[model samples]
Target: MVAHSAAKKDTGGGRESGSDAWKNYMRRQTITINYGRELPLAQGVEFKI
Candidate 1:
């Protein structure tokens, strides 16, 4: 997910006056597996470690 916002910058020693801020959130997942020699290898089997 992502969000955007803006802020203003002041000419004086104040905060900037620009409303161009972006916030991003990320989600990730991981999986693990074990295989044996007796199992037959399939033609379209993707392996990840």
Candidate 2:
């Protein structure tokens, strides 16, 4: 999971970054699972605080 906080004047970059991170993470997880691995390279989550 990704966690991010942005100010009212922000341009939503944080959200985009969080989404990208999640997508990459899921892809890695899928590859790992397909290879019969029990843990992903990133076992936890990406936090943008």
Q: Which digits, one per residue and each the tens of the lDDT, describe model 2 over residues 1-49?
A: 3233343125556666667776898999898677555436546865355
The digit string of per-residue lDDT tens for model 1 on 1-49 reads 1112222223332333221221111111111122444236654676565
Give the Cα-based TM-score of candidate 1 against the true structure: 0.18
User: Which runs in model 2 stand beyond 4 Å of their true positions?
Assistant: 1-13, 37-49
Q: Evaluated with TM-score, which candidate comes out highest? A: 2
Q: What is the lDDT of residue 45 in candidate 1?
A: 77
- List TM-score per model, in order: 0.18, 0.45
Off by over 4 Å in 1: 1-34, 38-40
